[model samples]
Target: PDFSHRLAEYAAALSTRLVDLRRTLAEQRPDTYLPDLATSLNNQSVRLAALGQTEQALQAITEAVDLYRTLAEQRPDTYLPDLATSLNNQ
Candidate 1:
């Protein structure tokens, strides 16, 4: 129980950070490092789900999958694997 609680807290914190990073990037240079951030968010979602934060995990991964899909469309060779992983996770 304690471990799961800690994991949920960590996932929430990480999700908040990712949101901040995305907002900052959008305000400063909208096209920069989005794919990388999305990948991080996807990984965080996986952690959240493992911790049993189902709704939050689904929301996070949904956003990540959308971003990955867009990235994969632009650069299939580079982002297809990431997109595939995110899809499988979802």
Candidate 2:
């Protein structure tokens, strides 16, 4: 139990760093990096959920869902499934 908690904590920290990096990249080249940022956010949500941080998890997934929604509008074929996944995650 202790090891699992520690692992979750470490994962959450790593996910936060990854999200920050992806967010910056996305800002620099939105067309190319938005999907990456969304993916990172989705992954971060999962890690946060594992740590039992429900509110933070919800916030991360909500942002991911919004990002996926915008992407889906551009390419539903590719992003609708992701949007659905993010919604489910939320």
Candidate 3:
């Protein structure tokens, strides 16, 4: 249980960092790292869910799915798989 709790905490912290990085990259690079941010968030969500942080995990995955949806709209071949994966997680 302690290990699970620690893992959840770490996942939450990493999610926060990913959000900050996404915002910074968006401002500095403008459309260059959005996919990376989305992927990181998706992975973080899985980690969060594994440790029972359902609400936070859901929020993270939802954001990832939204990002993937937008990206897929522009290039389905590249981002549709991500969208599908996030949707499955949701």
Best by lDDT: 2
Q: In candidate 2, list every pair of residues with a backbone clash.
A: none
Which RMSD does model 2 reach against the true structure? 0.9
Q: Give the top-scoring candidate (TM-score).
A: 2
What tens-digit string does per-residue lDDT give for candidate 2 at 1-90? Answer: 698898889989999999999999999999999999999999999999888898999999999999999999999999999999999988
Ranking by lDDT: 2, 3, 1
Q: Which lDDT values do the candidates have, in the order given?
A: 0.81, 0.95, 0.85
**TM-score, one value per model:** 0.78, 0.96, 0.81
lDDT of 1 by residue, 18-52 (tens): 77687577557647778767876787787778777
lDDT of model number 2: 0.95
lDDT, candidate 3, 1-90, per-residue tens = 598688778867877787778868866875898898888889888887887789988988998999999999999999999899999999
Output the better candidate (1/3) by lDDT.
Answer: 3
Candidate 2's TM-score reads: 0.96
What would the TM-score be for candidate 3 when compared with the true structure? Answer: 0.81
Q: lDDT, candidate 2, residue 16?
A: 99
Clashing pairs in 3: none
Cα RMSD to native, each candidate?
Answer: 2.2, 0.9, 1.9
Deviation of model 3 at 2, angstroms: 3.8
Candidate numbers, best TM-score first, in rank order: 2, 3, 1
